[model samples]
Target: MERIELPGFQDLRVQFDYDEDTGRIQYRKLSNKARRASSEAGHVADVGGALYRVVAVEYPSGKSRQVYAHRVIWKLMTAQEPPREIDHINGNTQDNRWANMRDGSGGANSKNRAMPKNNTSGACGVVWDKATGFWVARMGLGGVQRTLGYFENKEDAARAARSERLKNGFTERHGLPKSGLDKPQTLEDTLV
Candidate 1:
């Protein structure tokens, strides 16, 4: 399929009214074979397993193009094209509030992600090294994976991974469980 070029800020503003505070977009008027006046725009769709708000815009040539509502809001509110990547501050993909969205690099975005479902341990990058009988701490930065260290305890390994992540600019929310709480998991925390 051909990639559709995003319409300009002015072009989008003409078609829809964006609410920055709520991250909602509404149609200003009835368009050819599409939304009615003041109707909500966009529908929730799965984008890489996370749900995101997206809208299909009909072009002059009778072709429809889909765009992320966050990107559309960024353009309409800032009068600039959205960055190549945008991070949802709280890690909620559907929350498009102005305060919750920011431009980010691929690495920064990755660092802000929630712990993967496949992770057996409760922490990110702390895994069991069966052969060595140690908890291995590792991390990836800029497409390069590096081992932090090995620990006798999982919490120690988790702490090491967390420390390396912080030192390397990972978000505090990175590796957090789906509950979104920063639970006490490190041995240092218990000691304190």
Candidate 2:
């Protein structure tokens, strides 16, 4: 995949201190007047059911743009632009720890997603087919949706879906419950 270039990335590096290990970004000495130096730099954005950290960075040209915090950390840690999609290894979107992230393709990232809240069969790709009176298993591989098969038993369908996912390099953590570290208890806890 091609790397995504960020305008004024160098200036952003100068204005923030990114802790690669902890996945925290703090405002540096040249940060905006409203924020104090060494303070935490972003806000949490809940998209779908996932929480991502986003920061509004002001460039030298005086234009402010919002960027994903995980992408910024990837650039800082790798010293190169990151891929368009960043995947969380543990299926917890809010856990930005360096070890839990990877430069992911759309297919690979989709394979690592948490189970949907609306899932009725209690599995990632197994669903009840009302018309057929059978449990159906499906998978998305390399951007193509493929039907594994239909089964009379729900568990059999779920097993088929899981087997296909594993064969296609899906993580074991995928389809598990989604969770993350506790939110900051106080304003000071948000600081570096």
Candidate 3:
């Protein structure tokens, strides 16, 4: 079978009426031969919740294609493909609302992530260095992990980590939350 170029913003414009507020793509009016029209025109027949992909049928050939909703929505709104990843600001995969999405690098996207549930330390990047018996704070900058500072207290270490994260341009949401602040698991956890 021949490969087809992926449908882009201009291509989708003919088949979808995008609602940026809700991130929904509704089927638009089409003539009898339009592929998308094989279903219905009034509302997008298959669109449900925030699905990651949609099957779009071309107007003439009736060719069906799979497109990522977030990418398509970003293209429609911004008129360009994302520079890297399409990240959801609130950490919700299904919430593709226009404001929730942005173009970002892997490092930048990681900075917006919530602290992992498995993290025993209250800080996003701070870990108890058992060998040194100090609360070590570190952060990722431009894909490299850099040590921020070492502190005697977990709070101090967490603060240092937060400060470094902010100074490096990471959003506050990506910083450590309260739960990790005092979760010292090792001997160093108590040393702080």
Which residue pairs collide, candidate 1?
A: none
Question: Judged by lDDT against the true structure, how good is candidate 1?
Answer: 0.78
**Cα lDDT of model 3 by residue, 1-192, tens digit:** 122444666776776667668765556645435546334222222333323444453535567655555666676677665455667776555566788788767666777766766678866778999989999898878768798888887888887787777787777667544344334344234222
Where is the poorest 10-residue window by lDDT in model 2?
183-192
Global lDDT scores for all candidate models: 0.78, 0.71, 0.63
Task: In candidate 3, list every pair of residues with a backbone clash.
Answer: 122-180, 122-181
TM-scores, each model vs. reference? 0.86, 0.80, 0.67
Off by over 4 Å in 3: 1-5, 29-63, 176-192
lDDT string for model 1 (79-188, tens) is 87678788998888888889989887566688788888898877789888999999999998988989999889898888889888889888877887766534534435
Candidate topping lDDT:
1
> Compared to the true structure, candidate 3 yields what TM-score?
0.67
Clashing pairs in 2: none
Tell how far residue 121 is off in model 2, in angstroms.
1.7
The alpha-carbon deviation from the true structure for residue 20 of candidate 1, after best TM-score superposition, in angstroms, is 1.1
Write down the lDDT that model 3 would get.
0.63
lDDT (Cα, tens digit) per residue for candidate 2, span 1-192? 123356556776776787767777877754467666656777888775577887776667777777777877777777777887889876666678899899777677877776667776777788788999998999877667899999998777777887778788887655644432222223122111
